[model samples]
Target: MKYIVFFIGLTVVLLFFFSSCSDSNSDHENKTEPGIQHESMKAKTVGIDFAGHDFFQPVSNSISHIHGIGYPNNQEALFIATHHGLKVYSNGIWYETKEHNHDYMGFQATSEGFYSSGHPEEGSTLLNPLGLLKSEDFGKTIEKVSFYGESDFHHMSASYYTPSIYVVNTVPNSKLGTGLYYSLDGGEVWMQSELEGLPQASAHSLATHPRLAKIVGISTPEGLFLSHNNGNTFSLISEERSIGTFFIKDESILYVTADGEESLLEQSLESDDTKQIPLPTLSEGDSILYLAVNPLHEQEISFGTVAGDVWRTEDYGDSWSNILEKGNVP
Candidate 1:
């Protein structure tokens, strides 16, 4: 009888231990990490058709993990941020900025000059100190601005109508404060803006309408924020979602992309109203990274993804056509 009881007790203990282990593993899979979420992502072959012009015909040299994209005024040049430095595409020619070895994180161009921000070096100085570079002759050369010191910049946007004013988002270190900084004299000087009503979140994207200088939008990890008084104050516009890109066609219409999702959101900037526009769905393994909209036409926009997918939308975000597939145009 003693042997029988002991055997039964051992069986019960083994069953309980296995059940607890299985439950723990299940919980671990369901939990999400900070600043990251799990979702169904895919990569697909695509092309970009813009106003009867196909931009995917030209074979690209290499897609160097683009960090930002901009088109300057009075020139048919496309500026792209790369890990090595800034790359410029003008009149079917490509040029790279010299003497800068930092990773270009964001870019903003104006009639007088262009601005880019990134880390001075990778790894040890990512948050402690960051660098901002400026160029005048279309990425031929660059100069470092002396206003802000050692601040990690995440995103930057220049005013198209008002080129003198620019905004940058920085991650404050334990020694330096974190917030939005505005430059008025073409990045010659910078001042910390008052972010009273905006969420205390790091910014991922910054965009300013061509017509509305006072209205500016920012994409942050927490959500989206908009400022009407030129960064004096801000208001929360979207809930907690990772915003990768933001574009404002007019004073009333806005578009944004959420991280880990292929769907684009079209919202009314005048009020608290929004509508989701369907985009060309990515394959089962792709994820979008950034998006850009043409200033001349509200209906035309472009987006880049992790799968090296470049897509363009002629009818806004209602429909999309692929421009380049993975490894098609680097």
Candidate 2:
């Protein structure tokens, strides 16, 4: 009787997992409503959200100048944000979206779609400087948030599941002045953070909690600091010299530093514990520039390098697979 009951329980659990997975994939599709971008009394975007086609062509020379990297809500594939546009990697293959190539900068992926700032392509009806745009269909249908043509945020970090936004503004613009700014109401309103506990050195990079609206991080040449109060203040997390690049995955902050030998470390948010993930020997003059964690599969992580190299590890950094070499498809 015990054995039979155990078997029955296991079967039920497996069924529930499969059912949830099926629902997960369709939820984003059903919830995605087409969006429009309006600027100067003109339609900024008129592209179809889904082309009604499920086909993609293999692409090459699509990985250089990578600004950021991400995975869609479903974690079906990894998307590379580049100066030319967005390229995708899945099942050991690289593909590109036709006619949607735009200079994507400060890209942040979310549970629904993705957010970015950059310039639109030639045929794009949207404003030249994609001040801030949200794609409900992964860059097909874009919705204007703010700063339509005023600013192209180069350093931005936003919540993966919330409307919170934080950016390190390097230039002053109409909607924002140069400094650290954040918005909790989905870009409806904004506020500036005082950066109380951050080191005096220049902030090199930024990261934010995936679900928590207030949790954020900043890395400098001196150290890494995290803020629970939305950048109003911060607490020192690591003093390792940052190369101005890092990312957040769930409850941990993963960062890299150039201390003699380059290294990547994951630090727990709940404690001071830190452990290093194996490093793939990088060529001289190259450093990890961007990172993305598969939300659904935490063990799977990927990163892009300054030299346009990309690598993935499905077993939580135990091993790595080089997907792109110097921005080429091979």
Candidate 3:
């Protein structure tokens, strides 16, 4: 009787587990709501409410420049990297991570986890300039992969096609010989990348192609540069837009934002024609700070501004939905 009871209980638990997983998986797909807190925009949680979860609240009312934006492996939430820490928006709610309040400079979200290079939070003895740090458990804890105390990468990016990582090492690591470091083995090993024809080694922003690891697009003070032979050589693509920052959503499409420009330029690698689309001006003199495209949903794109305002467009820039604004937390 005891054995039969145990078997029955186990079977019931398994059935419940499977049922819950199936329901959860379907929930995200069925969610038709476009933006966060679509029904109630004025709802605000009380002070310091988030705990025992992967969420926190930004202490400041306004936000700094959004360094990076990405969705994790599950694509259930969008992660925003600001000067404060990692902020996640999911299921019509805004959540912030309490752990590791470091200023992530070179932030990138991958299916594996979050990778960054930045300064450590106050009261922590980790390092002033953290190089190649990763957090697999959603910004709860970060571990150093390489160049812990020696270097900082202001512009760093990882490729989705292959295990390739690139960074413009601002601080030279004596062992690594800095300028541009490339890691083919997922940050396990690093070496100096060949930047033969590039006018400027420093980059304001850099992006690796989604389909080819060899292809890279860099934005500098001079202009935008494209590399086809895996950073061995680079050719100047355009100097007309005064490209301040750029990101490659895929092998063909490169989204760019120029300095002091209000329009977002969507440039195609296959064609010389580019579309200059104006972003929604949430506040006065608002320009796009960073842009990110969902790997799972290629058409879905998200961009934020220095004023802590975020917007999303799901239909290839046909329309947009405001996610959140400064001083307003959902």
Q: RMSD to native for every prediction? A: 17.0, 15.1, 18.1
How many clashes in each candidate?
A: 16, 1, 2
Q: Where does model 1 exceed 4 Å of error?
A: 1-60, 74-77, 86-102, 111-113, 119-130, 147-152, 164-177, 201-203, 238-242, 257-260, 273-276, 317-319
Could you tell me the TM-score of candidate 1? Answer: 0.64
Tens-digit lDDT track for model 1 on 1-330? Answer: 000000011011111110011110011122332211233222121221212232222323565566666655424445566665655543434455443445665566554456676554343322213345565554434454532234434456777656445544333332224445666665555666565566554455567766566677766666677888767677778766766566666655444545554457777776767877667878677666566665545576676666656677768776776655662442
Backbone clash tally (model 3): 2
The estimated TM-scores of all candidates read 0.64, 0.82, 0.75
Ranking by lDDT: 2, 3, 1
Give the C-alpha miss distance for residue 175 in model 3, angstroms: 1.9
Minimal lDDT window, size 10, model 3: 1-10
- Per-residue CA lDDT of candidate 2, range 1-330, in tens? 000000011011111110011110111111222234332222122222222424346784446778789886455578888877878787777877765677887898877778898777666655556677777666655777777665666678889889888866544566655667899987769888877766555455678999888999877666778889988888888865554467786778888775556788888889879899997777777778788888877888898887789989998889998889899877
Model 3 lDDT per residue over 86-157, tens place: 777665567776656677777877666667876666676554566567665667656566666656565678
**lDDT score of residue 24 within candidate 2:** 9
